[model samples]
Target: MSAMLHPISRRLFLSGAAALGGVVMLHPFAARASANQAHLRLMETTDLHVHVFPYDYYADRPNDTMGLARTAAIIDGIRAEAGNSMLIDNGDFLQGNPMGDYIAYQRGMKDGDMHPIISAMNTLGYECSTLGNHEFNYGLDFMFKVLAGANFPFVCANLTKGSLAANARDDALFIKPYVILDKTITDGAGQDHPIRVGLIGFVPPQIMNWDARHLTGKAMTRDIVKAAEAWVPQMREEGADIVIALSHSGVGPAQYEENLENASLHLAGVDGIDAIVTGHSHLDFPGPKFEGMEGVDNAKGTIGGKPAVMGGFWGSHLGLIDLMLERDGKNWRVSASTSEARPIFERVDRKAKPLVESKAEVEDAARDMHEATLAYVRTAVGKTAAPLHSYFALVADDPSVQIVSQAQTWYIADMLSETEHKDLPVLSAAAPFKAGGRGGPDYYTDVPAGDIAIKNVADLYLYPNTVQAVLVTGAQVKDWLEMSAGIFNQVEPGKADQTLINTEFPSYNFDVIDGVTYRIDLAQPPKYDPKGNLINEGANRIVALEFDGKPIDPEQKFVVASNNYRAGGGGNFPDIGPDKVIFQAPDTNRDVIVRFIVEQGTINPAADANWSFAPVDGATVLFETGPKAKDFIADVKGVAIEAAGDGADGFAQYRITL
Candidate 1:
């Protein structure tokens, strides 16, 4: 057997005399022995979002909770046990945290100098990676530049380049459909056996909606299932033995009506896909069994009788899928498989402190980069007079969201001041970017009243979304909010509903236009398309739309403030298109938010009584919450908590009422 890796054996020497004294070390040999018995070990790091070093760029602190550093430690440990192991990332790698922004904006990615993510990834020796939708947040050119730094092949079957020349250029380094890995594995008899492993990658087709501007003419995306159908057979024809689908997509049941919207389950059923590795919803799939159907041997971690896994995001967990293969007269067949999503570090407190110590070599490799990244992110960008928080976003008008709305409005007003349509009223729509979920409880942005740094700006707007303002009629504006209201499910007047809204709906997509006052009648169904078209029979949910205390004029054209993605039809909302786009600002939303704070010097973005729940005065609604929110329950009037209950992903829940 190969030597085992001890990921947490580094000595934590105290300052002074203790530093020279003999150190106490935890033996990792036992852990290594346990893992070595597996035939083949597969490791996954998903939703890295450009967090190269373990440090949190947004907080400008040593965030032991997230970072590829800890994942590297786990990978090293696993590799020590099983000499033959593969490391793969499930995507969303390009944009999310501040390091991504720093590299994109400050240190422009060049051909040679390693992009931070690529730099760290190269150190860890990643085998291959797929594209997540967020990778398109930056334009294709920028994406190409950043990807150039990676040493491994970038695989995705759905995306296609425009010209044959471009396609040829991309095909050289960027693999279309998949790539085949010919590896040698050692058997119990200490003999080396050759294995042909084929890996196919897929991204959601919704990239067309999420990044239309960048992809419109330069590239195109196909549906995941269609892409798989076309490419998997090609991989099989290439004489590959085992086929694994690395889906930067996610798993969900077939919603007959919204079939094409999410493609995980549909893609899983595609022929030629032996095993599945999924991501992009930031979900953790400890095993192959999804949503109750269990033909998959999750204990073996196989999908459709093959091994599969999906690692949790932000370096929180490292997905380990072990497979046992039986020799089939010169080929190998899967005998058994098991999957587990293991956390690199456990949380010891509310501050996201790390409980498990990192391996010395991994820590040493990342220490300098982590410190430098932290120092770079901590430089003050501006200041704020109040503690910005997203605590009230889901329930009512929130100051954090108000600041974003203000930034959008201010930015759009300047950009539209000289346009021919300058006379039109300008309204801004912004959502809570830092609302907590997969990011954990402390994920919410809460910058105290003081000097706000670049890190703080990142916490405010996690993505590097550019600012865009679009011209639309009052009716279209109403339609936009109506689409946003789809996040909430209709609740009966006195029903004991435990869920408040589909938590699956991303908080950033739930735009709350600050200049408009509109009541969302929960009884009605969503009237607009995710692509912004009006469904004729859809319910009129945004009742009594008003601007500045008066009913909105249907024919009146107004400029609506939004991020570049939405103004470019990212959310599939109505009447928001490039044609209706009157202004496209160069500044990112994070920059605008920071500038707004600096210009105000002191901000009081308190919510005005513009909109409220209609006559739910006596009705109660059950809502789930995190442990961190327990302190804020007093702020919600007439709210009550039932006995505390377990929520998804280790979150705590409480029932509340109006």
Candidate 2:
């Protein structure tokens, strides 16, 4: 058997392995003592994202890091160890990988058809679930059709069918706001007592902006913390012995704000809310990932002084929250609690050691759909003359990003041919989706030269976001690039191996705009912060910005092709929103790439070196990427990267001199 270190586990040592004896493994609940007290174990699988089988449909290979099948093994083991247990999902299960795309686009769910992911969850006997932002990607009608397959109840307090009323209780909810499970818990004395477990769910209210066209008149969302404040009290009033908030949001910022996307920390502070299961940022809690944040007790797995856990995305971890409940005069109250996100695999010397094997029940439930997904992605659309990889995407203009930009430019130019903006110069913005980051050291686009299939295209462009072209002035374009430059750390002229990439900046936000030329001055401070706020307005990192052959005019208007996420203000970019969008297409960006490849017959997707770093005399910086990157080192343009050494975990180190 081959044991490979997945890119996702490459960073596990820093966040999980070392802290957990080289494995983030946990046994079942083991802390109840008295006859009046009972241990109720809660298991959570968040952001499954249709990864039911132990397979990566994009790579068309087995992956140990993700899959509900593997997670079920942990669930069964945990359930056996605890006297009382319940399993619920924290949303983001409907769609993610190629299997989801196959079901939604090709298989077409009928009224009674069982979605593969739902089938697996049903096999595992999931008690309840909630919604994530991606649930609305295929439209409301399609989402409902797929939801019909779920055997468990779905709850969401914030998502509503229409406009809000004066009071949240009067609003027309899209689904049941909450569900109370009436179960019996066995105490240490073997006494059986009735218990009511209340579970309420919340999705990011920003879904209104991300999926606006699909939800305009039919659906709306309320603020997350605000909704929880209104509903937790109601749940307690309805005789909920314990209240759990299934928040499909991230843990961030302790303070409350209206429509804050990552509000789980504040949501935990709501009175009557006993525990929480968080997701949406695809990160783990109770690990080093959430450590340093205020009001977050990472060592104790508590946020807002209440037990909480965030299972890593794509079925990588199982969130466990064990509450020690004591009978309070015929009712139950949580006395003590502990939480942790136990990973399915751990990293040791750059190799993966799977903690749990795939349970056959879940694998069997999703087997048929998995095979169909394989067939769907195997069909070739076109051929590529050169290999497409994203190993150095964060440090250079990459072909993987270039191909996407080319395809978007082609699609948007044709769309504008018959419009009033036909004369405007069309520019396309794209970023590397599969660049090695949190996904792991093995996570990079590596499509060999030759036939380009649906899988390859999917690898290059991961999201199902629709294409949108925004009309912005040249000055705004400069600002966009300046924002992208924020991903790099400032390098001093005489520095040696100073880290080049900012570990916190996501690769998807590092937009490289095609149809323009620019020089990034690394010596200058970044103009925009990671969240796209202009912190240093006078910092001019983007220098010699040009379009066509002349210096770009601040007043000149141009059509910039991008995805709905950017046009809809998903990334918080300054001066980039729906108001600047001149064209929005129903077609997805992935489909656009397929069509463009088909039209070209054999596409050559080599980087053109349109962008480069402005030399800061003798400055050198280092970064870590996939080990496979060494094979394509000679192909990267403009930057001369040499092997520095092996980095921590499984990543390879490379240095670039300016």
Candidate 3:
């Protein structure tokens, strides 16, 4: 005993001190490890839409706000703090921005060549992914080629192989309805438990209407909620401990009688679904507690105490859901849960900065592909004499849309070169692509006079749509404008106050056709359907139409230039279909816009006095704005700004009248 006590000599004491120092340094990590055993972290990137490398292909510049690279950085930091974690994408992984176009059309995704989106996703080791509506934009054959490059399982319950059974066998890109992954999680006792986590994916059925030509006879899509009900129970019967529904469909009210498109809340109420990851509306569900009615279990924030989350779109936010489970014998039941939305970038002094450091491996994987993507899109496609800006498109006459219409008309004009209708007067309808919406205030396109790069062309025509010319009557042309006027809400006469328009109506659908003159009677209701069918009895928004300063002849056939979607009975306008189509241009609207700019050397495609809102003299209306708009208000005519209200950080409000 005396020797043992004397063992605390200088040499031994120094060694003991060194050992204690090492333990202290490692204590924080040890405690963290113990705490993490009780919790599991899940990271989700939804609606990435081809932003893989943190660069805005439309802007042709590095954007810190978006991209899978920035999101990968955040995922790394989240994993470092959690005991166990998994990464997943919520779909809409394709068909947005110029990089997606660059890979799909320019570089071309072959069977072996790795697509940019697939390459970037592979770098992060995405455990699972779902299908989005945009995936069908390029048609089945092209989609198959691109999806073949992905290493992860492509899951979707609604889409099925139809009549293409033989083709499905030839291409292994066919996906299963659902997949059950056996994931092991360490419990509080430090025991590994094999948990069967079932994942089911759903895409909206509206693809049939939007991309019908691409999917015709090749594939079939079922309704989202119905598809979930059919497969979720099967997944549970497969010995799944927890079931997750990856719904590329969006969250709306459970009220279906009022609206058929509302599916999220209803999907949540479905049995066997433990949690849901939603997307497609491009909105963020910040917490498990959705915008449910009062007196509900706000704390749990679940449909039936089950968790749900919707990450924001375009890699803007990563959805995080933490579930706490209690063990009843060997079975696990979710006891408590919490959800949060973490953005990839945070604004500091009005500038976006990456919130975390990117994983070196992920960056290395996407670096070369990202650079090549940039170089490919940056190639000069054409030139423009005047600056292209969308400032006046929504509110008044705009040059931005005028240029697009000019391009469409010019392109269609050439395609009908050999047709008997070659000399027929041509009018082109185009909309503002950069109108403020999900892209935020900075979404507006403002290209100065000079070289119109390929990036600018993509920005001008965001979709990969080909040009088409419809044979429409003068009366039909008037109805077409009336359909576009649906973007505005009819103001009641003599009303003291009213909102100018229904903000829910997207601005991009508000078509402004060149080669015509008309006025939107705000008092009149819309006469056409979203698919371009005439429904209303006497909706006369376009009171008069003129060509070359002469009143349009209702019997005279005129070629109206529009995109393939609209000419193919999209937007539901009456008599604007393939039967009414006289010519279909080989060039896409994007390519035509580029060529138009190149030919002009400098173009003044400024919006002429084609249309305007009927004057509401002596009446005033309040218009909202961001601080950046204060300077631009002076440009608006006959409108007065009383004062600016305290709006959100990026938004400002103003009072104006017709």
Candidate 4:
């Protein structure tokens, strides 16, 4: 509804907050269109993942950067600024944090139950929504039950039931592949015209692999681009004036590969698709994040020459695509367009500053359930003798990661006691989930020493992945460690003041396998790239690897405990997939951790110094973490680190001498 959009910020106003007053009268389009021209504003929220309140249940604190209740203000303000607008959700609303877990695991959903997220969404004027991979985490029945409470209809073209029919359209799909909404458009001249708007939805095809346990034999999926090619043309043939795709995928190269997860770039090339609403990568479009991607115009927010937008995840931003439509004979064509992700808050001085307040109506809708979720997460489960934090998880063997490893090892050891691999050594693979990457500087976990609660446990393990154990040879374990060591960059011998951690490498993929000792030599090149691709074949960053006071034999087998995501090929790590998995427990990893903690009553989760960095001989490097890391710098073992200064992007910088 903004009349003008700033080039750099993509904000509606260059000066004051005039649009905050809400709902303005019909104004002239920014392009100054003729009487036949109309301006349509499309607003979207994606990957919300059950965060309806501006609160972090894990931290038990109010979070300004998250929550749809806060984003609802931005939505209301922008809709008031635009004369014509339609709101839609890009999916992933079913699961994410403790509130979702509390509802799915603790509070059961009855036939007519209303989920907190759905209740909050119903208050907002959403025309349609799509399915995200996380929606299947609770199984299809629970997902459909939650959707039944939504006020708007749901559409997903790619996800299907049973087996694939040779003709994609003829397949018995889980939901209607697409829907056409007949809407009235208001032109610049204040004239009204009837228009047919077609909206289609698509989820990543990888869901069949990622959620194989829930989807196998029950559901199937088609290639996103192929599905778009088959359905968009039919949508046009069905008297659709304009087609908009609600793609719950990320922006990748314009590579037309079948069953590719991030296929939004190629999906844009499909004929008859006018615009796209993209998400699932948790990034913002018209932002610097995707500026270098092939066929993506970050400034103009176009993918493969088609206008697109991906709102930041966790309700941080609202995706907006403003299209100036021109009448092309009997049909309307987009003459000019501008897209942006408007944030509800900004990071100033490493702290969250609210840009928009929570909407009263949306907050009221989710008020009761929000309190219930908080109560559920705050229940006392156990206690810890020492603090648990992941500030130095990437740099050293950390207690936060150690506790998860201990829990996993304990649970898996018992589960396999009666199995064929009972005699094999049990090792647990754990990673630092909240090591402060895209979640900002405050993302690190900090659970104080004392009584531990469900929220603290949830904070330690962010995802809802199930526990799994895989059997692999010693050589495969070394390869796995090499892949994990990719998180660090290769350093020149005796080079001072060099950077250490590779920011591109996600911390979750940096798995630390317990029950073994190893050394990561930064002097050698990494064997694997950040995307888990083999780069240096002969590189041996994981040197001096040993087990039980002896060098590990390459042929000897061991059972490693991990989550379903890693065991089911989520990160593309070598020699780690479903075939290698020997046992799959029905319990979630978070639940396993909780059970371990309860059994211990009060336990110490101290790091065992199982891993360390090989001395680089007077080499010094820079490391970054949350500012709060300064308080526990002395707790880091076997490394010489000192306060360096502030780093870019609001992170605290430190110098490490190896």
Top lDDT model: 4
lDDT of 3 by residue, 107-202 (tens): 766677777778888977677888887788677878878788888777887677663233322322248878887777765557566666778887
Q: Write the per-residue lDDT of candidate 4 for residues 1-658, one digit (tens) a residue.
A: 2222111133433211333643344334644866989888899999998889888787688999999988887776666667578889999988877788788878879999998899998988688999988899889999999999988889999888888889888878999999888777867777777788899999988676556668888999999988988899999998898899999998875757788778998989899999999998778997997868789888888988988999988899999998989877779888878898999888999999998778777888878888888887788768998889999999988999999999999988887775588899999999999998888899998998898998788679988678899999999999999999999988988789998989899999999999999999999999999888999999999988999989999999999999999998878899899899888664578877877887899979988889999999879999889999998888888778899999879999999888
Better of 3 and 4 by TM-score: 4
Off by over 4 Å in 3: 1-38, 163-173, 257-262, 287-305, 382-398, 404-451, 457-658
TM-score ranking from best candidate downward = 4, 2, 3, 1
**Tens digits of lDDT, candidate 1, 394-448:** 6666667777888888877776665587788888888887777667766676666
Please report how far candidate 1 places residue 102 from its true position, in Å.
Answer: 0.6
Candidate 2, RMSD to the unseen true structure: 10.1
TM-scores of all predicted structures: 0.62, 0.71, 0.63, 0.72
Model 1, residue 547: distance off in Å is 3.8
lDDT of 3 at 120: 82
| Cα lDDT listed for each candidate | 0.67, 0.85, 0.68, 0.86
Q: Could you tally the backbone clashes for each prediction?
A: 11, 5, 16, 3
Of the candidates numbered 2 and 4, which has the greater lDDT value? 4
Best model per TM-score: 4
List the pairs of residues colliding in candidate 2. Answer: 7-440, 7-441, 7-442, 8-439, 8-440
